[model samples]
Target: MNIEDLRDKDLQPQLDELIGSLTRMWATMLDCHRQQRAIIKLVSRSYNLKISFQSESQRQAALLLSVELRNLCSNFQNWMVAQVHETSEEEEEFQETCC
Candidate 1:
């Protein structure tokens, strides 16, 4: 596709819809990340409490799960940053070519 294709009015609505969907998805992800972090904090605080876990294995499992969740959150944040950077670069290129 050429610059004209990128500037086409027919694609504008689809692009707008995609941006809206992405914005909503980002908001949902942020909410979920906040909840996950809260859970991690709660689990970490109660890590030593015998009442929190029935057995050693269960405690270990909880610790592992929390670690994995933290990693997931970190990975997601990195991915988002990368995506933003990539989009910015693409926009710049598009403008340079089209304008």
Candidate 2:
């Protein structure tokens, strides 16, 4: 459609929602990356301990990372759901009339 034919008023909310979804998605990614680094640090510390291969703290950290990753996936799903298509009522009516 031409620029004059476009209605930014109706699109503004949808655009805002999309921006929110993107922001949430980015936050989730960063959180997961941060958790991954934490897990790596735990592993490295466990190795440095050198007393034995047994480390409850390292194990717990790994488990927590797994849970957090699962939670991140759930958050991503919510973010994706927030990006549903939105059209103005007038636009919908016009398309119906044309058809």
Candidate 3:
């Protein structure tokens, strides 16, 4: 599809779908981030004493916590990308059906 050949009216449905998808994604992401913060706080509190004590157990817990948080961040990123791709595919399908 040539960008120059596309009309705004013809693109409205896809645009609307994309906007709706984005709004939903944003809300979901916000909730997920909030939950992530809570989890991090819980982990931090559990390891807080360990941090000051500087024991092998504390080091292990800290390492594991960091890895878990990293994985969470990676997974969230992948999910967001997937949502975008899914929206695009849906838009394509919508266009096919309507036209």
The best candidate in terms of lDDT: 1
The digit string of per-residue lDDT tens for model 2 on 1-99 reads 756446465665676687578667766866775686577557546643434326899878867876886677567555544533222343476568746
TM-score of each: 0.53, 0.41, 0.49
Which residue pairs collide, candidate 2? none
The best-first sequence of candidates by TM-score reads 1, 3, 2
lDDT of all predictions: 0.73, 0.61, 0.72
Candidate 1 local lDDT, 1-99, one digit each (tens) = 787877676687787788678767766866776676687668667756655778999989988987897787679668767766776786688679757
| Model 3 Cα shift for residue 14 (angstroms) | 17
Number of the top candidate by TM-score?
1
Show the colliding residue pairs in model 3. none
Query: Candidate 1: TM-score?
Result: 0.53
Q: Which stretches of candidate 2 lie over 4 Å from their true place?
A: 1-5, 49-99
lDDT of 3 by residue, 26-88 (tens): 779768867876876676576535345369898789789778977986786677678668767
Candidate order by lDDT, decreasing, is 1, 3, 2
